[model samples]
Target: MEKKVFLLPFASVILLLHYWVTCLTLAVSLTNLSDEYALLALKAHITYDSQGILATNWSSTTSYCNWFGVSCNAHHGRLTALNLSNMGLEGTIPPQVSNLSFLASLDLSDNYFHASLPNEIGNCRQLRQLYFFNNELTGSIPQSLGNLSKLEESYLDSNHLTGDIPEEMSNLLSLKILSLFVNNLTGSIPSGIFNISSLQSISLSANDLYGNLPMDMCDRIPNLNGLYLSYNQLSGQIPTSLHNCAKLQLISLSYNEFIGSIPKGIGNLSELEVLYLGQKHLTGEIPEALFNISSLRIFDLPSNNLSGTLPSSMCCNLPSLEVISLSWNQLKGKIPSSLSHCQELRTLSLSFNQFTGSIPLGIGNLSKLEELYLGINNLTEYGSEGIVSTSDVYSNGIMLLEVFARKKPTDEMFVGDPTLKSWVESLASTVMEFVDTNLLDKEDEHFAIKENCVLCIMALALECTAESPEDRINMRDVVARLKKIRIKLLM
Candidate 1:
């Protein structure tokens, strides 16, 4: 009787152990199957796999972790990252992607992916880095994305996305870089975006966004490094508190409808490098304090109503100065000879202003000068020989006439006068005569404006005036060729 009792208890113990082992094995197999199914769904949705990347590599017979562009955690065997950038793959993101509950990073940049991002993406609680730039994806950003509390970087630029940036984006408290440029988005920028304290870069340029910037933009964003709000319709006075961003390296707020004087406080940012405030309605003198920033490289404040002569000691404190474009302003007085001190200067544009006197002869000392535009001013010939090169004269004249001339060919002013085409053609030959005296180098004057160079400039101008807009050269190509001509002149 004692032996029977001991054997019965031993048998029961073995049975319990077997049951627990079977349950653990089944649970692990189910977890593996779930991740595998999610990946298979993604492959099924891909319409065009040009290189057969998913077709050949992602198979049910293979382990999901071994698939191309995929990584799995060693301990838990869960998907952690998937990077398929520039893969030549085309597809819509499947909702089943949300099944990757352990996914942390997903990169689909530089591809041909189209269609709206799946709202189910918000369910991936572990997602941190998301890259969807340079795709053909359309539709507004999903508001459900705000649920990604741990998201760090989000790139959605160079797409056809329209509609307002979802106000719910404020919920991404851990966000750092937010790039949404080159889209068709409209409406005022959400004020809540400025309240995200952890943000480091905000790029919302090349859109139709309008409205005033928040009054206290820099108060909440202490770590901000770049602010690119250019090429938008934003209006109103620039906030006076912009200089509070101590770490700012780039501030591009050009091509807007902003009115009033530029906030002088911006000069206080010691780390500022590039400042572009061109093509706006800003008035008043260029702040003298801006010339004192030693780190400033490009100071572009063109096409505004700014007046007053440039400070004579402009280049004294600006050690890193490279390009100075202050064209189409009402600035007066003699061109400052002090500009010759900018050793790093590559481009110096001071055209279409009311400045008088000969071009400063000292400019010839800038051996690094590539582009020098000093046309359309009440200036005389160089008083000294071999002062500066006038190789870019013809092209500069073409741009000035095409961009600013108001007298049309059909206008009454041309009733008995030369037709616009004949006028341009006649002037093309004698264009060099009106070239600013400051730009001519008497020693190598023959090389300054070559005959072929003149013909090229005239051809470009005539093509630009084509009756059909499509017949004209692409503006991008025109600008690029002009830059090339300037470079060849120096060579």
Candidate 2:
């Protein structure tokens, strides 16, 4: 009787264990079914599939794991990755995608996906990589994206995305590359972003973002190699701590409202290859140490308030230097002859500055030079014997005389003159009498040289002020004529 009682209890125990096992199996099946349904929802949301990749392959006849652009974990049979990049798929990301609890990566870039990102995507707690760049996606980035704490790389650039970058994004401790370039994002960059030590590259260029860079920028990002923040309305002095990013290779902060001197410490970046800091309100002398970075290829710092002379050996250590643009600044002194040392130089623009003295004679030796700009400065042509060439003086004189004639057309000095045109016509012969006596006090013996320069200026000025505009030489022709005159004078 005792043995029978024990057997009955054992049978009941076996039945109970079987019931629980069956329930667990059913739960897992339901979960997998939900994932399949989520994928189907995505296919439904798609408006157009130009390549028919999804329409033809994402059919109910096959398992969701075998569908196009879909991947599943072999062990758990759960969706893990979906990459439809460059497939010409046009769709809206559906909220049903949140059902993919095991999803780790998603890429739908280079397509026509539009509308705000579905906030439910944050439910995929395992997501590590997200790419939505080169799409027509609009509206604010969903704030729930901050919940993706495991995300390593997020590329949402080249989209029509608007609104401020979510401050909560600083929660991504594992984030590496965060590229939001070419978007309409605005507002100050979240200070916490710079604190993420794991970031390798952060490109927020071509946006309308404003405000200063955090004072501690690059303090935590030791491995940062690329930083692009151009074409923004960002103001205030650039953070001096930027030099702390020792691995920096590219730094583009041009076309902004930044107001400060270029940080001298930036020269310490040995790996820097591209440095663009133009079209701002920067002042102070160009740092001589910048020339020591032999890896520098492109150096552009134009249209600023930078002053002082360039170092005599500016290009001595730069073997890879290709472009140098420093135009429309207040920089003065002679053009450095050392610039000819950059054998790879393709472009050199130094126009509209306060630079004076004769042009460097060795400039003509640059076989790779494709573009050269030296206009609107106090520059004169170089002479073989180091004296300013006659034609060079004439070109400089013509510009000054034109300015003087325009500013004081009715000055008392021209009271008896019929017109400024008539005065210039006779400027060559009577040039000595028209000037202040103190100007010619030192050297009065060079009257003939001065007369020839004035005569050349007179003829060019008359041609420029011809009665009919159609009869006057175009500006390009005038420049060519001046170059020819300089060549003849040199010969």
Candidate 3:
């Protein structure tokens, strides 16, 4: 009886061991066999496969492990990767793709696939990377995608995807890159998604998203390096906590309705490279703190209501600045002379403002100055004389020399003698010849006299430059003479 009982327990242990081994064997061979059907289903769903790689290489006759874009684990014989990016394939992604139970990576980027990402995608429990950016995929991102507990990266940008980002996305604790920019997404950003500690990059620009940016931004996403949320309806003050994102390099929140002063300590962000915050409802003086960020490359804050004087020491402070555009603001005060410190300043436009005072004379010293806009302002010197300024004129000399330079569009040889006086004086002998031949016909009247346009124009020039100011012809006489000249030319 004791031996029989012992044999029963031993047999139970052996059966348990056999079950585990059989399941292990099934797992090893299951991936390739299941992936063959999955790949075939994918081929069947493809309405347009411009390249016949799937038709040619993926077949029942060949091993599924040998198919193009299909990568398998040599040791386990499991389908671990599928990359059909830029393959010119067009069609819906079949739910059957999830049958590749051991798949780790799936890339259908830069293709024409147009349908909701299948909820079955979550079945690929080991999936670490999902690349479907630059496709025509529509409909909401499946909530089931949150079931991918192991997912590390997701790219769904440049698509037609709509609806709120699923709150279930917060389940992805390992997510590092979440890019869904340039989509048709609406609604406020899901605050829970920001809690993902491992996230390094988040791009949701060019969407219809609205609402105040969460004030606890840095606390939630401390590991972020790039945060692009531009071209949305975001309003309210830029959160002060943003400065705490010590590793942040690129911040683009432009084209929004954000109001109030820019965060005070933003300049303390030492790693910042590109800060684009244009077309917002922001106000206040240009912060001196901003100029101190030595790592700044492109600082754009145009089309705002920001006012006040720029710090005079900016040239010495901002050494890395390359592009700065502060146009269409209510800013006033002198353009700082120290701007020459930014030797690398490639583009500096400060147009359409109330900036008074002379442009800093030192600006001309910037050897690399490419664009300078300083118009529509009260910078020109004025006095009690309500007239525009001009060069000084002598009493008897009517400034004939400078006047001549303004007329003819000729070279240096014609510099001194381009006036109407010189033109007529050179042809004075021709007048006598015409009179003698009666070519200056009395019966011809105006046409005959008008034909002597050069002579009349010169006569008027001589009259205007007479030795006595009183003898100088009035501007009306010159106009009449010009009319006669035109009449003669037309005749």
**Candidate no. 2 TM-score:** 0.75
> What overall lDDT, based on C-alpha atoms, would model 2 receive against the true structure?
0.80
Which residue pairs show backbone clashes in model 1?
382-437, 386-442
* Ranking according to TM-score, highest score first: 1, 2, 3
Candidate 1 residue runs with Cα over 4 Å from true position: 1-18, 383-385, 388-395, 401-491
lDDT of 1 by residue, 101-145 (tens): 899999999989999888899998889999999999999898989
| Candidate 3 weakest lDDT stretch, 10 residues | 387-396
Tens digits of per-residue lDDT for model 3, 1-491? 45553355878999999999999888766655678889889899999888888878888887888888889888878789999999899999999988988899999999999989898888889999999999999999899999999999999999999999898999999999999999999998888887898999999999999988778888888889998888888888788888878899998888888999888778888899988778748899877888888888777887789998788887787787777777667888887878878888866656657877766656555667543444444554422223111101111112231132221112122324543335434655465422233334445656455446545554555575554546666555566767777776786
Give the alpha carbon lDDT tens digit for every residue of 1-491 in model 2: 55553355878999999999999999989999999999999899999999998888988898989998889999989999999999988889999999899999999999999998998988888999999999999999888888999999999999999999999898888999999999999998888898889999999999999998876687878889999898899889887887899999999888899998998889999999999888649999988889999999988888789999999899889989988888768989988989879999876767668888878867767779754556588876446535323333333333434343431222223335554456756654666544434433336576555455545655675675555546665666667776765665555
- Candidate lDDT scores, in order, read 0.80, 0.80, 0.75
Clashing pairs in 3: none
* Residue 28 displacement (Å), model 1: 3.4
Show where candidate 2 strays beyond 4 Å.
1-25, 382-476, 479-491
Clashes of each: 2, 0, 0
